[model samples]
Target: MTGKSRAPNLMVFGVLLCLGLLFLVLPAYHAGNLARIMVLAVYAMGYNLLFGYTGLLSLGHAMFFAAGMYGLGLSMTGWGLSPVPAFAVGVGAATLASAIIGFLALRTRGVAFMIVTLMFAQAGYLVILYFGAYTRGDEGFVIQQADRMIAGIDLSGDAARYFTAFILFAVCFLGLAWLVRAPFGRTLIAIRENEERAQMLGYDTTMYKLRAMIVSGAISGAAGAGYALLFGYVGATFATVQYSIFPLLWVLLGGAGTLIGPLVGVFFMFYLIDISSAVTSAYMLIAGLALVLLTLFAPQGFAGELRKRVFAWLP
Candidate 1:
Protein backbone atom coordinates (compact mmCIF):
# COMPACT_ATOMS: atom_id res chain seq x y z
CA MET A 1 0.00 0.00 0.00
CA THR A 2 2.88 2.34 0.64
CA GLY A 3 5.44 3.48 -1.91
CA LYS A 4 8.18 1.56 -0.08
CA SER A 5 6.22 -1.69 -0.50
CA ARG A 6 5.58 -1.25 -4.21
CA ALA A 7 8.86 -2.82 -5.28
CA PRO A 8 8.28 -5.99 -3.30
CA ASN A 9 4.71 -6.21 -4.54
CA LEU A 10 5.81 -5.77 -8.14
CA MET A 11 8.47 -8.44 -7.71
CA VAL A 12 5.93 -10.83 -6.26
CA PHE A 13 3.55 -10.14 -9.11
CA GLY A 14 6.32 -10.68 -11.61
CA VAL A 15 7.20 -14.00 -10.03
CA LEU A 16 3.59 -15.12 -10.20
CA LEU A 17 3.34 -14.02 -13.83
CA CYS A 18 6.44 -16.00 -14.68
CA LEU A 19 5.12 -19.06 -12.91
CA GLY A 20 1.87 -18.83 -14.85
CA LEU A 21 3.76 -18.63 -18.12
CA LEU A 22 5.57 -21.84 -17.23
CA PHE A 23 2.36 -23.76 -17.80
CA LEU A 24 2.53 -22.89 -21.49
CA VAL A 25 5.57 -25.13 -21.83
CA LEU A 26 4.09 -28.10 -20.01
CA PRO A 27 2.77 -31.12 -21.90
CA ALA A 28 -0.88 -30.77 -22.87
CA TYR A 29 -2.06 -33.53 -20.56
CA HIS A 30 -0.10 -32.16 -17.63
CA ALA A 31 -1.08 -28.60 -18.41
CA GLY A 32 -4.79 -29.30 -18.49
CA ASN A 33 -4.80 -31.32 -15.30
CA LEU A 34 -2.46 -28.88 -13.54
CA ALA A 35 -4.75 -26.04 -14.46
CA ARG A 36 -7.63 -27.87 -12.84
CA ILE A 37 -5.50 -28.41 -9.75
CA MET A 38 -4.71 -24.71 -9.66
CA VAL A 39 -8.40 -23.94 -9.74
CA LEU A 40 -8.94 -26.27 -6.78
CA ALA A 41 -6.05 -24.59 -5.03
CA VAL A 42 -7.69 -21.24 -5.56
CA TYR A 43 -10.84 -22.60 -4.00
CA ALA A 44 -8.80 -23.88 -1.10
CA MET A 45 -7.17 -20.51 -0.58
CA GLY A 46 -10.59 -18.89 -0.50
CA TYR A 47 -11.72 -21.32 2.13
CA ASN A 48 -8.53 -20.69 4.09
CA LEU A 49 -9.38 -16.99 4.16
CA LEU A 50 -12.19 -17.76 6.57
CA PHE A 51 -11.70 -21.21 8.02
CA GLY A 52 -7.99 -20.97 8.48
CA TYR A 53 -7.53 -17.29 9.23
CA THR A 54 -10.86 -16.50 10.81
CA GLY A 55 -11.24 -19.83 12.61
CA LEU A 56 -14.61 -20.43 11.01
CA LEU A 57 -15.00 -23.89 9.58
CA SER A 58 -17.67 -23.82 6.90
CA LEU A 59 -19.05 -27.01 5.36
CA GLY A 60 -21.15 -25.30 2.72
CA HIS A 61 -18.70 -23.62 0.36
CA ALA A 62 -20.06 -26.00 -2.24
CA MET A 63 -23.06 -23.73 -2.26
CA PHE A 64 -21.05 -20.85 -3.65
CA PHE A 65 -19.07 -22.98 -6.08
CA ALA A 66 -22.18 -24.68 -7.38
CA ALA A 67 -23.84 -21.32 -7.77
CA GLY A 68 -20.99 -20.12 -9.98
CA MET A 69 -20.91 -23.23 -12.14
CA TYR A 70 -24.67 -23.41 -12.61
CA GLY A 71 -24.95 -19.69 -13.16
CA LEU A 72 -22.31 -19.69 -15.87
CA GLY A 73 -23.58 -22.89 -17.46
CA LEU A 74 -27.15 -21.60 -17.64
CA SER A 75 -26.06 -18.18 -18.85
CA MET A 76 -24.00 -19.58 -21.67
CA THR A 77 -26.14 -22.55 -22.66
CA GLY A 78 -29.70 -21.52 -21.91
CA TRP A 79 -29.49 -17.71 -22.00
CA GLY A 80 -26.96 -17.51 -24.83
CA LEU A 81 -24.85 -14.94 -23.06
CA SER A 82 -21.23 -14.41 -24.03
CA PRO A 83 -18.42 -15.82 -21.92
CA VAL A 84 -17.55 -12.59 -20.13
CA PRO A 85 -21.10 -11.73 -19.13
CA ALA A 86 -21.95 -15.30 -18.33
CA PHE A 87 -18.94 -15.58 -16.06
CA ALA A 88 -19.89 -12.32 -14.43
CA VAL A 89 -23.36 -13.64 -13.77
CA GLY A 90 -21.90 -16.76 -12.26
CA VAL A 91 -19.63 -14.82 -9.91
CA GLY A 92 -22.49 -12.53 -9.00
CA ALA A 93 -24.79 -15.42 -8.23
CA ALA A 94 -22.17 -16.99 -5.99
CA THR A 95 -21.60 -13.68 -4.23
CA LEU A 96 -25.32 -13.30 -3.58
CA ALA A 97 -25.65 -16.85 -2.35
CA SER A 98 -22.66 -16.53 -0.02
CA ALA A 99 -23.92 -13.27 1.38
CA ILE A 100 -27.29 -14.71 2.22
CA ILE A 101 -25.96 -17.96 3.61
CA GLY A 102 -23.05 -16.38 5.45
CA PHE A 103 -25.32 -13.87 7.11
CA LEU A 104 -27.36 -16.68 8.55
CA ALA A 105 -24.42 -18.92 9.40
CA LEU A 106 -22.53 -16.14 11.17
CA ARG A 107 -25.37 -15.89 13.63
CA THR A 108 -24.04 -19.13 15.12
CA ARG A 109 -20.57 -20.33 15.94
CA GLY A 110 -18.58 -23.57 16.18
CA VAL A 111 -20.60 -26.65 15.25
CA ALA A 112 -23.78 -24.64 14.97
CA PHE A 113 -22.25 -22.48 12.24
CA MET A 114 -21.02 -25.52 10.40
CA ILE A 115 -24.38 -27.18 10.48
CA VAL A 116 -26.19 -24.09 9.25
CA THR A 117 -23.90 -23.72 6.29
CA LEU A 118 -24.19 -27.39 5.41
CA MET A 119 -27.97 -27.25 5.58
CA PHE A 120 -28.03 -24.24 3.27
CA ALA A 121 -25.65 -25.94 0.85
CA GLN A 122 -27.72 -29.11 0.80
CA ALA A 123 -30.83 -27.02 0.25
CA GLY A 124 -29.17 -25.38 -2.75
CA TYR A 125 -28.31 -28.78 -4.22
CA LEU A 126 -31.91 -29.86 -3.79
CA VAL A 127 -33.07 -26.77 -5.63
CA ILE A 128 -30.85 -27.75 -8.51
CA LEU A 129 -32.33 -31.25 -8.39
CA TYR A 130 -35.88 -29.93 -8.32
CA PHE A 131 -35.27 -27.72 -11.31
CA GLY A 132 -33.53 -30.48 -13.23
CA ALA A 133 -35.56 -29.86 -16.38
CA TYR A 134 -34.24 -26.34 -16.64
CA THR A 135 -30.74 -27.27 -15.48
CA ARG A 136 -30.87 -30.57 -17.43
CA GLY A 137 -31.81 -32.51 -14.29
CA ASP A 138 -28.99 -34.68 -12.92
CA GLU A 139 -27.01 -34.68 -16.13
CA GLY A 140 -26.32 -30.94 -15.98
CA PHE A 141 -26.05 -28.26 -18.68
CA VAL A 142 -23.45 -28.58 -21.38
CA ILE A 143 -21.77 -25.29 -22.26
CA GLN A 144 -20.85 -24.58 -25.85
CA GLN A 145 -19.41 -21.28 -26.94
CA ALA A 146 -19.26 -20.20 -30.57
CA ASP A 147 -18.16 -16.62 -29.98
CA ARG A 148 -15.16 -15.02 -28.37
CA MET A 149 -16.61 -13.05 -25.47
CA ILE A 150 -13.40 -11.87 -23.89
CA ALA A 151 -11.40 -9.34 -25.89
CA GLY A 152 -11.89 -11.43 -29.04
CA ILE A 153 -9.84 -14.26 -27.59
CA ASP A 154 -11.38 -17.70 -28.00
CA LEU A 155 -11.12 -19.52 -24.68
CA SER A 156 -13.03 -22.61 -25.77
CA GLY A 157 -9.92 -24.49 -26.81
CA ASP A 158 -8.03 -26.52 -24.19
CA ALA A 159 -4.74 -24.65 -24.46
CA ALA A 160 -6.43 -21.28 -24.31
CA ARG A 161 -8.54 -22.36 -21.39
CA TYR A 162 -5.50 -23.64 -19.57
CA PHE A 163 -3.71 -20.35 -20.05
CA THR A 164 -6.77 -18.43 -18.95
CA ALA A 165 -6.93 -20.52 -15.80
CA PHE A 166 -3.23 -19.95 -15.18
CA ILE A 167 -3.72 -16.22 -15.35
CA LEU A 168 -6.69 -16.38 -12.98
CA PHE A 169 -4.82 -18.54 -10.50
CA ALA A 170 -1.75 -16.34 -10.56
CA VAL A 171 -3.79 -13.20 -9.98
CA CYS A 172 -5.81 -14.80 -7.23
CA PHE A 173 -2.76 -16.20 -5.49
CA LEU A 174 -1.04 -12.84 -5.34
CA GLY A 175 -4.22 -10.95 -4.54
CA LEU A 176 -5.04 -13.32 -1.71
CA ALA A 177 -1.53 -13.05 -0.35
CA TRP A 178 -1.81 -9.28 -0.38
CA LEU A 179 -5.21 -9.41 1.26
CA VAL A 180 -3.96 -11.53 4.16
CA ARG A 181 -1.24 -8.98 4.85
CA ALA A 182 -3.60 -6.01 4.90
CA PRO A 183 -5.06 -4.39 8.01
CA PHE A 184 -8.48 -5.92 7.48
CA GLY A 185 -6.91 -9.31 7.04
CA ARG A 186 -4.95 -8.80 10.24
CA THR A 187 -8.21 -8.06 12.01
CA LEU A 188 -9.63 -11.32 10.75
CA ILE A 189 -6.56 -13.06 12.08
CA ALA A 190 -7.12 -11.40 15.38
CA ILE A 191 -10.64 -12.71 15.38
CA ARG A 192 -9.31 -16.14 14.70
CA GLU A 193 -6.80 -15.90 17.49
CA ASN A 194 -9.40 -14.69 19.95
CA GLU A 195 -12.80 -13.26 19.14
CA GLU A 196 -13.44 -11.92 22.58
CA ARG A 197 -10.10 -10.16 22.70
CA ALA A 198 -10.57 -8.69 19.24
CA GLN A 199 -14.05 -7.47 20.10
CA MET A 200 -12.81 -6.01 23.35
CA LEU A 201 -10.08 -4.19 21.46
CA GLY A 202 -12.74 -2.31 19.47
CA TYR A 203 -12.73 -4.41 16.31
CA ASP A 204 -16.08 -5.47 14.92
CA THR A 205 -15.41 -9.20 14.88
CA THR A 206 -18.74 -10.11 13.36
CA MET A 207 -18.35 -7.59 10.55
CA TYR A 208 -14.81 -8.70 9.86
CA LYS A 209 -15.87 -12.33 9.67
CA LEU A 210 -18.68 -11.43 7.30
CA ARG A 211 -16.29 -9.50 5.04
CA ALA A 212 -13.97 -12.49 4.93
CA MET A 213 -16.90 -14.71 4.02
CA ILE A 214 -17.88 -12.39 1.17
CA VAL A 215 -14.39 -12.38 -0.29
CA SER A 216 -13.90 -16.09 0.24
CA GLY A 217 -17.25 -16.83 -1.36
CA ALA A 218 -16.39 -14.67 -4.37
CA ILE A 219 -13.09 -16.44 -4.92
CA SER A 220 -14.76 -19.84 -4.57
CA GLY A 221 -17.32 -18.77 -7.12
CA ALA A 222 -14.66 -17.58 -9.55
CA ALA A 223 -12.87 -20.92 -9.26
CA GLY A 224 -16.15 -22.70 -10.00
CA ALA A 225 -16.79 -20.57 -13.06
CA GLY A 226 -13.30 -21.22 -14.39
CA TYR A 227 -13.75 -24.97 -13.87
CA ALA A 228 -17.06 -25.06 -15.70
CA LEU A 229 -15.72 -23.10 -18.64
CA LEU A 230 -12.57 -25.16 -18.82
CA PHE A 231 -14.46 -28.46 -18.63
CA GLY A 232 -17.48 -27.26 -20.68
CA TYR A 233 -20.09 -28.67 -18.32
CA VAL A 234 -21.90 -27.87 -15.08
CA GLY A 235 -23.51 -30.66 -13.12
CA ALA A 236 -25.31 -30.93 -9.77
CA THR A 237 -22.37 -32.93 -8.45
CA PHE A 238 -20.46 -29.70 -8.09
CA ALA A 239 -22.88 -28.62 -5.37
CA THR A 240 -22.64 -31.75 -3.31
CA VAL A 241 -20.86 -32.20 0.03
CA GLN A 242 -18.57 -34.70 -1.64
CA TYR A 243 -16.98 -31.82 -3.53
CA SER A 244 -17.16 -29.37 -0.65
CA ILE A 245 -14.85 -31.42 1.56
CA PHE A 246 -11.99 -31.41 -0.93
CA PRO A 247 -11.15 -27.79 -0.25
CA LEU A 248 -11.22 -28.47 3.47
CA LEU A 249 -8.86 -31.38 3.04
CA TRP A 250 -6.63 -29.29 0.81
CA VAL A 251 -6.40 -26.45 3.29
CA LEU A 252 -5.82 -28.70 6.26
CA LEU A 253 -3.23 -30.79 4.51
CA GLY A 254 -1.40 -27.73 3.19
CA GLY A 255 -1.25 -25.95 6.54
CA ALA A 256 -4.43 -23.98 6.76
CA GLY A 257 -2.86 -20.62 7.62
CA THR A 258 0.03 -20.77 5.18
CA LEU A 259 -0.14 -18.71 2.00
CA ILE A 260 1.18 -21.25 -0.51
CA GLY A 261 0.16 -24.26 1.53
CA PRO A 262 -3.05 -24.86 -0.40
CA LEU A 263 -1.13 -25.00 -3.66
CA VAL A 264 1.23 -27.55 -2.23
CA GLY A 265 -1.62 -29.59 -0.83
CA VAL A 266 -3.46 -29.62 -4.16
CA PHE A 267 -0.32 -30.62 -5.99
CA PHE A 268 0.46 -33.40 -3.55
CA MET A 269 -3.04 -34.77 -3.23
CA PHE A 270 -3.97 -34.54 -6.90
CA TYR A 271 -0.84 -36.33 -7.96
CA LEU A 272 -1.09 -38.75 -5.10
CA ILE A 273 -4.54 -39.69 -6.25
CA ASP A 274 -3.25 -40.07 -9.79
CA ILE A 275 -0.43 -42.25 -8.68
CA SER A 276 -2.65 -44.33 -6.43
CA SER A 277 -5.13 -44.88 -9.25
CA ALA A 278 -2.60 -46.76 -11.38
CA VAL A 279 -2.17 -49.37 -8.66
CA THR A 280 -5.65 -49.66 -7.20
CA SER A 281 -9.26 -49.48 -8.30
CA ALA A 282 -10.36 -47.81 -5.07
CA TYR A 283 -8.00 -44.89 -5.34
CA MET A 284 -10.01 -42.65 -3.06
CA LEU A 285 -10.07 -45.26 -0.35
CA ILE A 286 -6.32 -45.61 -0.38
CA ALA A 287 -5.88 -41.85 -0.56
CA GLY A 288 -8.16 -41.47 2.42
CA LEU A 289 -6.13 -43.99 4.34
CA ALA A 290 -2.93 -42.21 3.47
CA LEU A 291 -4.45 -38.93 4.59
CA VAL A 292 -5.48 -40.44 7.88
CA LEU A 293 -1.99 -41.73 8.45
CA LEU A 294 -0.41 -38.41 7.49
CA THR A 295 -2.76 -36.42 9.69
CA LEU A 296 -2.01 -38.63 12.61
CA PHE A 297 1.72 -38.47 12.10
CA ALA A 298 1.91 -34.76 11.40
CA PRO A 299 -0.92 -32.89 13.04
CA GLN A 300 0.33 -29.47 11.95
CA GLY A 301 -0.09 -30.44 8.28
CA PHE A 302 2.49 -30.84 5.52
CA ALA A 303 3.56 -27.23 5.18
CA GLY A 304 3.28 -26.54 8.84
CA GLU A 305 5.43 -29.53 9.65
CA LEU A 306 7.96 -28.48 7.07
CA ARG A 307 8.06 -24.99 8.50
CA LYS A 308 8.49 -26.25 11.98
CA ARG A 309 11.30 -28.61 11.10
CA VAL A 310 13.03 -27.11 8.07
CA PHE A 311 11.86 -23.66 6.98
CA ALA A 312 11.25 -21.68 10.11
CA TRP A 313 10.71 -18.48 8.10
CA LEU A 314 8.03 -19.78 5.72
CA PRO A 315 5.22 -17.35 5.07
Candidate 2:
Protein backbone atom coordinates (compact mmCIF):
# COMPACT_ATOMS: atom_id res chain seq x y z
CA MET A 1 0.00 0.00 0.00
CA THR A 2 1.01 3.58 -0.60
CA GLY A 3 2.10 5.64 2.41
CA LYS A 4 -1.27 7.37 2.63
CA SER A 5 -3.16 4.09 2.40
CA ARG A 6 -0.78 2.37 4.80
CA ALA A 7 -1.09 5.05 7.51
CA PRO A 8 -4.40 3.87 8.97
CA ASN A 9 -3.35 0.22 8.98
CA LEU A 10 -0.08 1.03 10.71
CA MET A 11 -1.85 3.22 13.24
CA VAL A 12 -4.38 0.52 14.09
CA PHE A 13 -1.68 -2.11 14.38
CA GLY A 14 0.33 0.13 16.68
CA VAL A 15 -2.66 0.62 18.95
CA LEU A 16 -3.44 -3.09 19.12
CA LEU A 17 0.24 -3.83 19.80
CA CYS A 18 0.31 -1.30 22.62
CA LEU A 19 -2.81 -2.80 24.17
CA GLY A 20 -1.40 -6.32 23.86
CA LEU A 21 1.83 -5.25 25.51
CA LEU A 22 -0.01 -3.48 28.31
CA PHE A 23 -1.93 -6.64 29.06
CA LEU A 24 1.35 -8.41 29.72
CA VAL A 25 3.03 -5.63 31.75
CA LEU A 26 0.18 -4.18 33.77
CA PRO A 27 -0.91 -5.58 37.12
CA ALA A 28 -3.93 -7.83 37.19
CA TYR A 29 -6.25 -5.18 38.61
CA HIS A 30 -5.32 -2.61 36.00
CA ALA A 31 -5.41 -5.21 33.27
CA GLY A 32 -9.00 -5.96 34.22
CA ASN A 33 -9.85 -2.26 34.23
CA LEU A 34 -8.35 -1.86 30.77
CA ALA A 35 -10.49 -4.73 29.57
CA ARG A 36 -13.63 -3.00 30.79
CA ILE A 37 -12.46 0.26 29.23
CA MET A 38 -11.93 -1.47 25.92
CA VAL A 39 -15.50 -2.80 25.92
CA LEU A 40 -16.87 0.59 26.89
CA ALA A 41 -14.75 2.17 24.19
CA VAL A 42 -16.49 -0.04 21.67
CA TYR A 43 -19.77 1.41 22.89
CA ALA A 44 -18.40 4.95 22.59
CA MET A 45 -17.19 4.29 19.05
CA GLY A 46 -20.69 3.23 18.08
CA TYR A 47 -22.03 6.48 19.47
CA ASN A 48 -19.36 8.42 17.59
CA LEU A 49 -20.39 6.91 14.28
CA LEU A 50 -23.81 8.54 14.52
CA PHE A 51 -23.12 11.68 16.54
CA GLY A 52 -19.65 12.57 15.36
CA TYR A 53 -19.76 11.34 11.78
CA THR A 54 -23.43 11.57 10.80
CA GLY A 55 -24.38 14.55 12.98
CA LEU A 56 -27.28 12.62 14.44
CA LEU A 57 -27.42 13.02 18.20
CA SER A 58 -29.28 10.34 20.13
CA LEU A 59 -30.44 10.12 23.74
CA GLY A 60 -31.73 6.55 23.78
CA HIS A 61 -28.84 4.37 22.75
CA ALA A 62 -29.09 2.59 26.09
CA MET A 63 -32.07 0.77 24.64
CA PHE A 64 -29.92 -0.80 21.93
CA PHE A 65 -27.29 -1.68 24.50
CA ALA A 66 -29.92 -3.13 26.77
CA ALA A 67 -31.47 -4.94 23.86
CA GLY A 68 -28.28 -6.85 23.27
CA MET A 69 -27.62 -7.45 26.95
CA TYR A 70 -31.09 -8.72 27.66
CA GLY A 71 -31.22 -10.65 24.44
CA LEU A 72 -28.20 -12.64 25.50
CA GLY A 73 -29.19 -12.74 29.13
CA LEU A 74 -32.68 -14.04 28.50
CA SER A 75 -31.76 -16.41 25.72
CA MET A 76 -29.34 -18.15 28.03
CA THR A 77 -31.24 -17.85 31.29
CA GLY A 78 -34.67 -18.59 29.88
CA TRP A 79 -34.01 -20.75 26.82
CA GLY A 80 -30.79 -22.62 27.70
CA LEU A 81 -29.02 -21.43 24.57
CA SER A 82 -25.23 -21.63 24.54
CA PRO A 83 -23.05 -18.57 24.82
CA VAL A 84 -22.14 -18.45 21.13
CA PRO A 85 -25.70 -18.63 19.81
CA ALA A 86 -26.91 -16.35 22.56
CA PHE A 87 -24.31 -13.78 21.61
CA ALA A 88 -25.54 -13.78 18.04
CA VAL A 89 -29.11 -13.49 19.26
CA GLY A 90 -28.12 -10.53 21.38
CA VAL A 91 -26.49 -8.70 18.46
CA GLY A 92 -29.39 -9.59 16.21
CA ALA A 93 -31.85 -8.19 18.72
CA ALA A 94 -30.02 -4.88 18.84
CA THR A 95 -29.83 -4.79 15.05
CA LEU A 96 -33.53 -5.35 14.73
CA ALA A 97 -34.31 -2.77 17.39
CA SER A 98 -32.14 -0.22 15.64
CA ALA A 99 -33.73 -0.94 12.29
CA ILE A 100 -37.17 -0.37 13.74
CA ILE A 101 -36.16 2.70 15.70
CA GLY A 102 -34.26 4.18 12.76
CA PHE A 103 -37.18 3.70 10.42
CA LEU A 104 -39.36 5.75 12.73
CA ALA A 105 -36.89 8.21 14.23
CA LEU A 106 -35.26 9.21 10.93
CA ARG A 107 -38.60 10.65 9.94
CA THR A 108 -37.82 13.50 12.30
CA ARG A 109 -34.69 15.58 12.74
CA GLY A 110 -32.87 17.64 15.35
CA VAL A 111 -34.44 17.77 18.82
CA ALA A 112 -37.48 15.86 17.63
CA PHE A 113 -35.35 12.90 16.68
CA MET A 114 -33.65 12.95 20.04
CA ILE A 115 -36.95 13.04 21.88
CA VAL A 116 -38.35 10.16 19.84
CA THR A 117 -35.34 8.00 20.55
CA LEU A 118 -35.37 8.82 24.26
CA MET A 119 -39.02 7.94 24.43
CA PHE A 120 -38.44 4.63 22.72
CA ALA A 121 -35.65 3.82 25.14
CA GLN A 122 -37.79 4.70 28.11
CA ALA A 123 -40.44 2.36 26.79
CA GLY A 124 -37.92 -0.41 26.44
CA TYR A 125 -36.78 0.06 30.02
CA LEU A 126 -40.35 -0.07 31.24
CA VAL A 127 -41.01 -3.21 29.26
CA ILE A 128 -38.00 -4.86 30.81
CA LEU A 129 -39.36 -4.03 34.24
CA TYR A 130 -42.85 -5.19 33.36
CA PHE A 131 -41.41 -8.61 32.66
CA GLY A 132 -39.44 -8.66 35.84
CA ALA A 133 -40.13 -12.33 36.46
CA TYR A 134 -38.23 -13.27 33.35
CA THR A 135 -35.59 -10.54 33.51
CA ARG A 136 -35.20 -10.35 37.29
CA GLY A 137 -35.91 -6.59 36.75
CA ASP A 138 -33.89 -3.86 38.46
CA GLU A 139 -32.22 -6.35 40.80
CA GLY A 140 -30.98 -8.14 37.68
CA PHE A 141 -29.71 -11.70 37.34
CA VAL A 142 -26.26 -13.22 37.04
CA ILE A 143 -24.99 -15.81 34.60
CA GLN A 144 -23.03 -18.55 36.29
CA GLN A 145 -19.52 -19.34 35.11
CA ALA A 146 -20.70 -22.46 33.37
CA ASP A 147 -22.93 -20.42 31.07
CA ARG A 148 -20.13 -17.97 30.29
CA MET A 149 -18.17 -20.30 28.06
CA ILE A 150 -17.75 -20.39 24.30
CA ALA A 151 -16.04 -23.08 22.21
CA GLY A 152 -14.62 -24.64 25.40
CA ILE A 153 -13.03 -21.38 26.55
CA ASP A 154 -14.19 -19.89 29.84
CA LEU A 155 -14.83 -16.19 29.46
CA SER A 156 -15.31 -15.92 33.21
CA GLY A 157 -11.58 -16.29 33.71
CA ASP A 158 -9.56 -13.08 33.95
CA ALA A 159 -7.20 -13.63 31.02
CA ALA A 160 -9.89 -14.96 28.75
CA ARG A 161 -12.19 -12.07 29.53
CA TYR A 162 -9.49 -9.46 29.05
CA PHE A 163 -8.29 -10.81 25.72
CA THR A 164 -11.84 -11.33 24.53
CA ALA A 165 -12.55 -7.69 25.25
CA PHE A 166 -9.31 -6.73 23.54
CA ILE A 167 -10.23 -8.64 20.41
CA LEU A 168 -13.71 -7.13 20.34
CA PHE A 169 -12.39 -3.59 20.74
CA ALA A 170 -9.69 -4.07 18.11
CA VAL A 171 -12.09 -5.45 15.51
CA CYS A 172 -14.60 -2.64 15.97
CA PHE A 173 -11.91 0.03 16.14
CA LEU A 174 -10.23 -1.07 12.88
CA GLY A 175 -13.53 -1.72 11.15
CA LEU A 176 -14.85 1.75 11.94
CA ALA A 177 -11.60 3.46 10.95
CA TRP A 178 -11.72 1.78 7.56
CA LEU A 179 -15.44 2.45 7.16
CA VAL A 180 -15.11 6.18 7.78
CA ARG A 181 -12.62 6.30 4.91
CA ALA A 182 -14.93 4.49 2.49
CA PRO A 183 -17.34 6.07 0.02
CA PHE A 184 -20.43 5.17 2.06
CA GLY A 185 -18.84 6.66 5.16
CA ARG A 186 -17.91 9.79 3.22
CA THR A 187 -21.49 10.11 1.99
CA LEU A 188 -22.69 10.08 5.62
CA ILE A 189 -20.23 12.84 6.36
CA ALA A 190 -21.54 14.82 3.42
CA ILE A 191 -25.05 14.44 4.77
CA ARG A 192 -23.84 15.48 8.18
CA GLU A 193 -22.32 18.59 6.70
CA ASN A 194 -25.33 19.48 4.52
CA GLU A 195 -28.24 17.13 4.18
CA GLU A 196 -30.12 19.33 1.79
CA ARG A 197 -27.12 19.59 -0.48
CA ALA A 198 -26.56 15.84 -0.35
CA GLN A 199 -30.19 15.32 -1.32
CA MET A 200 -29.77 17.88 -4.08
CA LEU A 201 -26.76 15.89 -5.26
CA GLY A 202 -29.19 12.98 -5.73
CA TYR A 203 -28.21 10.99 -2.68
CA ASP A 204 -30.82 9.43 -0.41
CA THR A 205 -29.99 11.14 2.87
CA THR A 206 -32.68 9.37 4.89
CA MET A 207 -31.59 5.98 3.69
CA TYR A 208 -27.99 6.75 4.48
CA LYS A 209 -28.88 7.98 7.94
CA LEU A 210 -30.93 4.88 8.60
CA ARG A 211 -28.07 2.69 7.53
CA ALA A 212 -25.72 4.62 9.77
CA MET A 213 -28.06 4.21 12.70
CA ILE A 214 -28.31 0.46 12.14
CA VAL A 215 -24.55 0.13 11.94
CA SER A 216 -24.12 2.29 15.01
CA GLY A 217 -26.70 0.29 16.96
CA ALA A 218 -25.21 -3.03 15.91
CA ILE A 219 -21.81 -2.09 17.25
CA SER A 220 -23.24 -0.80 20.50
CA GLY A 221 -25.19 -4.02 20.91
CA ALA A 222 -22.09 -6.07 20.31
CA ALA A 223 -20.37 -4.27 23.15
CA GLY A 224 -23.36 -4.92 25.37
CA ALA A 225 -23.45 -8.58 24.45
CA GLY A 226 -19.77 -8.90 25.09
CA TYR A 227 -20.16 -7.23 28.45
CA ALA A 228 -22.88 -9.63 29.53
CA LEU A 229 -20.96 -12.70 28.43
CA LEU A 230 -17.59 -11.69 29.78
CA PHE A 231 -18.64 -9.90 32.94
CA GLY A 232 -21.37 -12.43 33.74
CA TYR A 233 -24.01 -9.89 34.68
CA VAL A 234 -27.04 -8.32 33.04
CA GLY A 235 -28.84 -5.55 34.81
CA ALA A 236 -31.43 -2.79 34.35
CA THR A 237 -28.86 -0.12 35.14
CA PHE A 238 -27.30 -0.61 31.72
CA ALA A 239 -30.56 0.50 30.13
CA THR A 240 -31.00 3.69 32.08
CA VAL A 241 -30.72 7.26 30.79
CA GLN A 242 -27.36 7.62 32.51
CA TYR A 243 -26.01 4.81 30.36
CA SER A 244 -27.27 6.58 27.25
CA ILE A 245 -25.43 9.75 28.20
CA PHE A 246 -22.13 7.95 28.86
CA PRO A 247 -21.08 7.36 25.24
CA LEU A 248 -21.84 11.00 24.46
CA LEU A 249 -19.52 12.06 27.25
CA TRP A 250 -16.80 9.69 26.08
CA VAL A 251 -17.04 10.75 22.43
CA LEU A 252 -17.04 14.47 23.21
CA LEU A 253 -14.20 14.21 25.74
CA GLY A 254 -11.95 12.26 23.35
CA GLY A 255 -12.90 14.08 20.11
CA ALA A 256 -15.87 13.72 17.90
CA GLY A 257 -15.47 12.43 14.35
CA THR A 258 -12.01 11.03 15.05
CA LEU A 259 -11.16 7.32 15.08
CA ILE A 260 -8.98 7.22 18.23
CA GLY A 261 -11.10 9.70 20.14
CA PRO A 262 -13.46 7.17 21.66
CA LEU A 263 -10.67 5.02 23.10
CA VAL A 264 -8.83 8.05 24.46
CA GLY A 265 -11.98 9.44 26.01
CA VAL A 266 -12.88 6.11 27.60
CA PHE A 267 -9.41 5.68 29.05
CA PHE A 268 -9.32 9.24 30.38
CA MET A 269 -12.72 9.08 32.04
CA PHE A 270 -12.10 5.65 33.55
CA TYR A 271 -8.80 6.68 35.14
CA LEU A 272 -10.06 10.07 36.19
CA ILE A 273 -12.81 8.40 38.19
CA ASP A 274 -10.53 5.67 39.44
CA ILE A 275 -7.88 8.07 40.78
CA SER A 276 -10.31 10.68 42.01
CA SER A 277 -12.49 8.33 44.03
CA ALA A 278 -9.40 7.11 45.83
CA VAL A 279 -8.54 10.65 46.98
CA THR A 280 -11.91 11.85 48.23
CA SER A 281 -15.60 11.14 48.57
CA ALA A 282 -16.47 14.05 46.25
CA TYR A 283 -14.81 12.57 43.20
CA MET A 284 -17.57 13.75 40.93
CA LEU A 285 -16.89 17.32 41.91
CA ILE A 286 -13.30 16.92 40.79
CA ALA A 287 -14.38 15.21 37.61
CA GLY A 288 -16.86 18.00 36.92
CA LEU A 289 -14.20 20.66 37.38
CA ALA A 290 -11.79 18.80 35.14
CA LEU A 291 -14.46 18.46 32.47
CA VAL A 292 -15.27 22.16 32.65
CA LEU A 293 -11.61 22.98 32.19
CA LEU A 294 -11.40 20.64 29.22
CA THR A 295 -14.49 22.23 27.69
CA LEU A 296 -13.06 25.71 28.02
CA PHE A 297 -9.58 24.89 26.77
CA ALA A 298 -10.03 21.84 24.55
CA PRO A 299 -13.53 22.07 23.20
CA GLN A 300 -12.75 19.73 20.34
CA GLY A 301 -11.55 17.10 22.88
CA PHE A 302 -8.05 15.65 23.47
CA ALA A 303 -7.76 13.65 20.27
CA GLY A 304 -9.59 16.29 18.25
CA GLU A 305 -7.19 18.96 19.47
CA LEU A 306 -4.21 16.68 18.84
CA ARG A 307 -5.40 16.01 15.32
CA LYS A 308 -5.90 19.70 14.71
CA ARG A 309 -2.47 20.79 15.98
CA VAL A 310 -0.13 17.82 15.66
CA PHE A 311 -0.95 14.62 13.82
CA ALA A 312 -3.00 15.72 10.83
CA TRP A 313 -2.98 12.10 9.70
CA LEU A 314 -4.56 10.82 12.93
CA PRO A 315 -7.29 8.24 12.14
Task: Give the top-scoring candidate (TM-score).
Answer: 2
lDDT of each: 0.84, 0.93
**For residues 127-223, could you state the per-residue lDDT of candidate 1 as single tens digits?**
9999988886678867766543477767766678777887788878889878888998889889999999999999988888888999999999998
Cα lDDT tens digits, model 2, 197-310, are 999999999999999999999999999999999899999999999899889989999999999999999999999989999999998887788788989999999999998998
List candidate 1 segments past 4 Å from native.
1-18, 145-149
| Worst 10-residue lDDT window, candidate 2 | 1-10
- Could you tell me the lDDT of residue 101 within candidate 2? 99
**Candidate 2 lDDT (Cα, whole model)?**
0.93
Please list all clashing residue pairs in model 2, or write none if there are none: none
Candidate 1 at 59: error in angstroms?
A: 0.5
Regions of candidate 2 where Cα sits further than 4 Å from its true position? none
